[model samples]
Target: MTHRRRPNDRLRTLLKEADWTQEALARAVNTLGAEIGCPLRYDRTAVAHWLSGTRPRHPVPQLAAEALSRRIGRPVTPEAAGFPVPWREPAGEDPVTGFAALCRSDAETGSRLVLQQRPYRVADARAPSPPALPEIPAQRPAADRDPASPGPPQAGAGGPELAALHDAARFFAASIDTHGGRHARSALSTYLADDVTPLLTAPRPSPSRREMLGAAARLAFLLGRMYEDGQLHGLAQRYYTYAHRLASEGGDRATWSLVIRAMSAQAQRLGHLSSALQMGDAAARAAQGLAPSQQSYVQAQFAVILAQTGERRGALSALATAERAAEHAACGQGGSPFDTYPRAALLFQTSQVLEALGDLPGAIGALRRSAAERAEADVRGRTLTHARFGQMLLRTGRLDEACAAWRRFLSGRERLRSGDAERALREMRRALRPYRNRRCAAELLALSVPLTEHS
Candidate 1:
């Protein structure tokens, strides 16, 4: 027997506040769905059903929340609209199996799984880590392979697969750096679900199994980065958690540290200071006994967290430790991209610390150095740097220079597919609104309007 449903007063209240008809809300959701490549034919009837407590599928609730958010000029979460949060990681699931499911979901739905999900709150982050996985198990039968698994293992088991994964990781990393995370993200997810999952379950020697786990962890980390770039922080956090597990199982503490550091950064970006500090401290601890460059990378992130929390002395100490480590790190080392910590990244972290400490000029100086040191091929990084630099200049009353920096950001953003860049464009518009009459602001606004029309 079916149970009776209660009316969704939360959604009704939001609709009343926005003064939007059911048809208008449905149309908005449909429009957003189409933009994200998930076309829909939702109408007033479907919306009425939602109001009557008939929950829609995978992304409709999310789409509805986002549509409302845009109209209301603030965040409208799924929970705010009386809908359960979409695509949450299941409780106490096996890490490997859960990760496979996540990959398949991402591959099948593209960005639909993440496009409307908000960053998880700090309270949600307190859940215990997944328990340590048992040793790699023997291969299952061909008939036992899941949808995400390949039919069977290829002829060359260990070395070849690992090498290919490494190559794919590097290629995707470079692609993300140059073109931004939206570039080939679907393809990458598909590769992980369809190609990589098989090797993960394939029978192998102990050493070979560990190596495969490490390689897979790196790919997962890259996928997490892509999600993070899209500003899908909750989805990114899931990926990072899985990657950390993979690294830990593979006996790869360095990769584990990197993943943890990534989590800390995500928390910091979301303004969860205590959680960020906790994760930052953990990441630094994990980085112990790692190489100088890797240690420096972890330390620098910790320094940013410290500065944000008013721990000036601790921040300075951490920064100095990072500096010494970087000075000792040899450039041009051949290893995983995660293994190398470039000067540009360190300087960017330095800029963040200074900005947190309320030193605008010092932050600007550090950011300029970062921009200068950035590799020419790193278009996404350079664009983001310029965007940050523009914001910094704007804060210092340097309107002309801010506009100049933003011009550079727009120039590079043309080739990028980053959500961060998109947000930066919106921020620029807001910052320049007060100075719209100024020649620099007007000229820049005119230039940027066409670029962000559909954003």
Candidate 2:
């Protein structure tokens, strides 16, 4: 037989068993909030709500459980508080339940399930709120000690180890973007399994150690995204799994969102509309209660994923919401990496969704906006946007416009690494295939020569 318990009773039982007074619980919650840059203000009434069967918002429940667990010197989970198990989905469940289930699924299976499902409805993709974006403190020392620090330290010296890990992660991420995962998958995976995982599982975990783990997780996630981009789903899934575990240990929601975004992207690419939508929904839910910048990031990604799943209208709506949230985040008084929500990135994402939806005019408009916002130093981003725009123009039978776009794109390719520039060129050639040997096509082909020579 199944057991049913009231939310209040659960809270009371946990408090009694742990011997914590309401005041004590409130203090712990507030303290943790402060550490994570959340500035939470819980009182007896909040605890009363728990007893009265009201579920706290996203992140709060997890926060309370973690805080209580630390106080009692044991691990506590959300399940203990009378809510449904996190990330589990029942067969034939609602969109929310299905989305949760996708998150709970192991990375490999989850990715495959997402890829196999195809085309989600926009109505089913709505999220209760935006994703979590942590408010990183202005001072490095203060930020490091903030309860919001996601993971523990590596087994060795904390500060240096984390710095090394972050540097390494950034290096690998750059390599993946330049060379593609197919060329470096084995080496990347070995780094995760051999070098990174050991540090994560080592004894005597410290704050620095956790930070290293988080860095490693991000690297693994980038590898996964690279693999996904290269159309290697199987390899991508493995990397995502490692990344997710590391993120969990580090307790970095941003890292976790990164992994989920990669997984969702793979699903969308493979035509698993329902599954992709489900993953996007979960990501949106997970990000709720985060800083405005963080919310903007998640919402923007959600918009892209929804568009990939064929939810054109829903996708547009999501894009609008993302823009508004980002504006709010930019205006808010706080310091964080979250504040680096690139306007170019948002416009680029909007262009992608519009292109997928076959809205050429809309896509072109977004791309123009993206190009305008892109800094000259961001050569790679500019090249990518130009290539995409050129292809879109080619598709819509605007030969002259397409040629102009390709020429402009090629001009920027000189500053980029050879591999990406070549890839962009190849894509441009493919888009120009139908008009091969034609005047416009030949002119475009001539422009490609100089770019190739420079590479």
lDDT of each: 0.79, 0.62
Quote each prediction's TM-score: 0.78, 0.59
Largest lDDT belongs to which candidate? 1
The alpha-carbon root-mean-square deviation between model 1 and the true structure, to one decimal in Å, is 8.8
For model 1, residues 154-197, the per-residue Cα lDDT tens digits are 34546678888888988999999999987898899899999998
Model 2, 1-455: lDDT tens per residue? Answer: 12233656766888887888887888777765533324478987777776667776544665577566765766666667554444422446432223223333323443433332211122222222322444453544543433333433334546665666666665665554344444454565555555555555566445555566567767767666655544445435545655665666556676666566556665665455665677677776676655556667777878988777678788888888888877876663332232346688788888888777878799899998898888655666777788888888777788888888888887776555534456678879877777877998887876676665542
Best candidate (score: TM-score): 1
Give per-residue lDDT, candidate 2, residue 320.
85
Alpha-carbon RMSD, each predicted model: 8.8, 18.5
Runs in model 2 lying further than 4 Å from the true structure: 1-157, 173-195, 206-209, 229-231, 308-313, 331-339, 356-358, 411-426, 446-455
